[model samples]
Target: MAGAQTYESTRARVEQYFDRTATRTWERLTSDAPVSGIRATVRAGRDRMRDLMLAQLPQDLTGARILDAGCGTGALAVALAARGADVVAIDISPALIDIARRRQPEGLPGRIEFRAGDMLTPELGHFDHAMAMDSMIYYGAADIAGCLGRLAPRLAESFVFTLAPRTPLLMAMWRVGQVFPRADRSPTMVPHSVKGIARAMRRAEVQGNLRQIERVNSGFYISSALEFRP
Candidate 1:
């Protein structure tokens, strides 16, 4: 992994790329009439992440208004709704949101609302809880605090965000890549180290608990559960 890219320009470029690719990816993930094999990959990834998030959340999801930020394919949103939370799942890509809306399970008692929009924006209202799974990787360092800060007021009392940890080894590799700017300007995929994440939370005036858990092979995702003042 290269060093983390936190430049504003780089962040904008990454978002643009995602908007372009989201359509194809969404279509491939939601092909359910015949159940395409690619759908399995989407299902597996969503299942792994949803299960982990649900296990970590302490609140009863029943009837709670939960916001699923960067809700790709809406797996977490759908799952949360099925478990009783009233969900508002938002994503930047319309293609992905369409797929997620189409995949809404039949006769689900819990309500789910899908929106196509950016998480950094203020339109998304505060809710009982919010979760950004694997979505913070797109932000530049300058935007991390702003992104989370905007959501703080919307949180009724708590929120959760998952991020890829920026490690020392990864930072070194990223620095080496910076020397060869033309080779592959792609910044490191790692977002923030554990310490850096803590700082970000403090900067955002968010408080509660932070934990790092290894989800797959050797990689870890940091989960920050925030308790906000009413």
Candidate 2:
């Protein structure tokens, strides 16, 4: 039941956080760490989510128009362009958009356009597919539904996004973490359960399916990807 102001405030905070840590996030997304430890495990989990999303995309993206909603540092945008999909990448953080534009690969068959703005309100053209990796974690269920309601109409095929899983154990851990003082806690990291995701998707009038991806300690489900179609 968060109001528009609440959602906007949350997004503003997230934008600021990402603006400050854009470079750090870029490194994490493209790092080459040792392949057998905590860092490796974490990287593998992230890669799995990205790979799962990429797998859902059409193999032949020639002349396709793809929307990279909430495209953090343009990693996925660049990947889509490499596959011959014209990509329009949007993010709330100007710094992240700047980095994305700077890091854009040269001589790709498809073009990439980076924009700094809210995904829900951007006046972009229609697209064949949309992907919002790891970015919708900032919004509440209601806000997510609102975003989908706005975005679904502009897509010709489907939309894919990731959300932090809201299991009981994970919620308890989150509460415990909030009880303590932490400098690195993101104010916008709102996790949603699978049921919550479904409800939001339903509210947005989209058919949604989820696949659990990252599980930690074999107990807490860390995240999942949701694919939606009209």
Candidate 3:
């Protein structure tokens, strides 16, 4: 709740960009559909990152309730459910949520539930663990920390999320994106240093030991994940 207004503003931009403009692009990218070489690298990077996060968790997730924050087209949700995890996959984009619900396989009625809304909504109930893949990239460390501060109370075990690294290339790209804003383009991602994020987390009074995980880089895609546990 520290940067409520800023977080909400970024959240709205993300929702609008994904829901109104990038639905088909995401659907195709998340699928086996052919894409350009650069996009192929992005797809590969995301796959590896997803697997990396999954590997950090227990193999048998039976009875474990997980929040798949910003689950795009249901890949992570489906994978988590396959491991017997009860997953609540939420995205801000209703269009993407529709695709996710449709892509969700049958016979796993309660295995995964798809919803379109804020991931911090208390109505989604508590979770043992949560994973927010590429969801907080558009927000700064302060806003990211604030969002986590709100979500920490409902999470009993731990949560993991990815952020754009504060590399020179990424910073340049961010600046360019801001200067030449396009209505159809995805919102510009704000890069953050690990130390900056940690400081923000401490200032927010979010009780947790923050750990830096691996960074994934493939062509145009570059991201690092951070894990927090009480």
Question: Which candidate comes out best when scored by lDDT?
Answer: 3
Model 1, position 29, has a per-residue lDDT of: 48
TM-score of each: 0.72, 0.83, 0.96
Residue 102 displacement (Å), model 3: 1.2
Q: Write the per-residue lDDT of candidate 1 for residues 42-103, one digit (tens) a residue.
A: 45555565676777665467878888888877878877887788888987767688778888
How far off is residue 26 in model 1, in Å? 5.3
How far out, in Å, is residue 72 in model 3?
Answer: 1.0
Evaluation by lDDT, superior candidate among 1 and 2: 2
- lDDT, candidate 3, equals 0.90
TM-score of predicted model 2? 0.83
Better of 1 and 3 by lDDT: 3
Instruction: Select the stronger candidate by TM-score from 2 and 3.
Output: 3
Which parts of model 1 have CA positions greater than 4 angstroms off? 1-11, 26-46, 58-60, 168-188, 203-209, 213-215, 218-230
TM-score of 1: 0.72
By summed lDDT, which 10 consecutive residues of candidate 3 come out lowest?
101-110
lDDT of 1: 0.62
**lDDT of each residue in 1-230, candidate 2, tens digit only:** 23478778878878877777545655454555334455565566766777788888987799999999888778889889989999999999887887788788799888999999987764787889999987888778878777766776787888888887776766776678668846566553576876776677676565445445443332222567877775
